[model samples]
Target: MEVTTLTRVYRYDGIDLPVPPHLAGDPSALRAYHATLYPAILNAEAVDLGVSNGALVTEYRRAVGTKGR
Candidate 1:
């Protein structure tokens, strides 16, 4: 028999969120949600990493305006 282990990591306020039952049991759903959420999460992380909130907001506005064209 082969055994495998899976790990998921999330940080919140310098602490970790507990793994939910859905994520632990359904790998595909977890993967899909992660993919959908990744961009927003990464953008927030970039904002935290020294990018000013005003700059981030302005960039987001520009992106939306460009996409609306």
Candidate 2:
């Protein structure tokens, strides 16, 4: 069987907060703003959470920067 792994990171206040392995596969990991704690990059204002993908975190910062909130 092929092995697949996903690391969930929460980027909060310029820090990378890694999600515990136990919560890695949580179904509520992704959701719209105010729907869940997990913050999708597109919904930067929705949460103060981080993401595993560095690129996504960059994008989130850019988006937030433009908003200046």
Candidate 3:
């Protein structure tokens, strides 16, 4: 009998995130789906990154205010 080990690392914002086996393979479908729903994806990612929807909206408003200033 023989045994082997495998490891993979994925990072987002300098932090590691887990990848499911299916997504670890081909990501074309995932890419296409994200492209088609980018706005929703952005909101979800913001939430995942610890920023609530209201917080993100506030941040965007602050950015725009700074740009105008």
Top TM-score hit: 2
- Cα lDDT tens digits, model 2, 1-69, are 975554444454465545555654562453232134434444454343444453223212423345355
Residue by residue across 1-69, what tens digits does model 3's lDDT show? Answer: 875443444333344444467765554444334435343333333222233333211111111123333
Candidate 1, residues 1-69: lDDT per residue as tens digits? 975453544443443334477675574454445436344432233112222422211111111223333
Instruction: Give me candidate 2's TM-score against the actual structure.
Output: 0.31
Q: Each candidate: what lDDT?
A: 0.38, 0.42, 0.36
After superposition, the stretches of candidate 1 with alpha carbons farther than 4 Å from their true spots are 1-4, 24-43, 46-69
Worst 10 residues of 2 by lDDT: 55-64
Candidate 2 lDDT (Cα, 0 to 1): 0.42
Per-model TM-score, in order, reads 0.27, 0.31, 0.30
Q: Candidate 3 versus the native: TM-score?
A: 0.30
Model 3 clash pairs? none
TM-score ranking from best candidate downward: 2, 3, 1
